[model samples]
Target: MAAGTRSRTGASAAEVATRIREAIFAGELVPNQRLVEADLAEAYGASRGHVRTALGELTVEGLVERIQNRGARVRSVPLEEALEIVEVRAAVEALCAARAAERVTDEQAERLRGIGRRMEDAVREGDQAAYAQGNKDLHGAVIGLADQRTAAATIDRLRAQAVRFQYRLSARPGRSQTSLPEHLAIIEAVCARDPEAAARAMREHLASVARAIAESARD
Candidate 1:
């Protein structure tokens, strides 16, 4: 009975952590916002102990921070730090793009092209949320095509932190439209089976996004 109760508590805490992480990614919970244990316990319908466990998990993910005296808050990833992360992600994605170009089938290439089309449509309709999701799908597809599970998992962790910045960038005027061409270039290079070009395109695209994110942070 005690073991069963412990298992249930752990599961509840994990669910609560996932929910909070999704909220952070969706911008419902902005950066640096305070995370009160009592508030979260009430909001998530979990015990205070469960909420603490959830916060501990998020803190490990770099999604939340706990100061010495101040309980906990959403981690405000500084622009410099975020740019550093973006650079690392660009390298990881460049490798994925290169490998994908070498290994991707015609069907997989077409799917990558489809992601570009969806992104274009999202931009035309001014749907930032859809565009953000499309962006994730586009990168995820490339990683999948690369077939490197360990590398993909690393990218996923970095992406979790990057999504908030990407979502914010999507809201900037003309940013989404501007990014469409970059995505198309990446798809074109990969589809053409040009590994070097594909890698370069992916790197350049992420570098541009890093610049945009930094610029937006200044405004």
Candidate 2:
């Protein structure tokens, strides 16, 4: 087998799945774009079998869809469904924030504060890209602090499905400015070790996001 067509032994199915998942999240693999097994196998340095396995796994995660006769493609979540997904994320991530507040170590608290600072800098400099990245980093940090594998896994899958909508929301005029304080509230609550406050802040932030999504759908 050529280097590009490595044997299944080269990369595991789970590894291939992660590569494809990250590609989707990064917008490298766009919504409704066909995922040809042969192309994926070569691009990801995996066997066709592994690519197939990966596609099946991603389908289960709601990131990929198989057409009746056509091959798998990136799933395009509709705006309405996207709003529902955010609603669900709000609940689950609120739980994570509450747990993180209860369980955060001093070092973790410092990290959360650092992320908040970066977000503030990004907004001050009118750096939307940096602010968007900080948004992801802050949420990821809080989830890590929570140490709840189940909730983290759930959030990851939900995020994968709604990443396109997230990109849209981030690019909207004044979006980063509006969301900055909401994210800071989450960070401050978590850093303060106040579980109720953390959960409330998280819920409010996502509620704001959900409302934004709904508003955009009408425009």
Candidate 3:
């Protein structure tokens, strides 16, 4: 995000933090990447104080690191740390899946179905942008069904870590073709109101992702 995003009236510390975090997650900022305060202040069109506050928040959240006598830069997540994140995500997502199965409404189900359709189209057309958008939609929809803001927030953070690994391995093979089908299976189970099945499917889906991430990390 241009640090100086013109003059947005709704501009606040939290908003600035979120924007910078997303930029870091989207690979606009690489691991161990230094952030120039003046440049960011100018780009964000905010004072150095505002940018500093945003950086402090992001640092606390583990998205960026600050060193004494140095400066702030994006943190580098080790492979072990990445695997731990995947494991935690598996359990939390499984709970959310089961919860969604118990409480999901028809409207929510349809919303998820729409996301699935888009992802399928992306897979068919081999469109990276579409796949990226669809993937976020599918995950966010599931998290929304659970209505657990804390879980959703944590997943966003973990996904940031995963995105770094993806950036490190640029041009690597696409995520497993089977991953989409696995997501669909979980969605179907939730829509069917099959909590047990949904939990199992979600677990399997995350397990597969963990495996894929580990393989890529080793390479």
Most TM-score-accurate candidate: 2
Q: Model 2 over residues 10-61: C-alpha lDDT tens digits?
A: 6767778989999998989999999999998888777888889889989989
Global lDDT scores for all candidate models:
0.86, 0.90, 0.80
Flag clash pairs in model 3: 2-43, 3-43, 3-44, 4-43, 4-44, 4-45
Per-residue CA lDDT of candidate 1, range 41-65, in tens? Answer: 8888777787888899889988899
- The TM-score ranking, best first, is 2, 3, 1
Task: Please state the error at residue 135 of candidate 3 in Å.
Answer: 1.4
Which of the predicted structures, 1 or 2, would earn the higher TM-score when compared with the native? 2
Sort by lDDT, best first: 2, 1, 3
Off by over 4 Å in 1: 1-11, 125-127
* Model 3 lDDT per residue over 63-143, tens place: 889978888888888888888888999888888889899999898888888888888888889886787677677777778
- On TM-score, the stronger of 1 and 3 is 3
RMSD of 3: 3.8
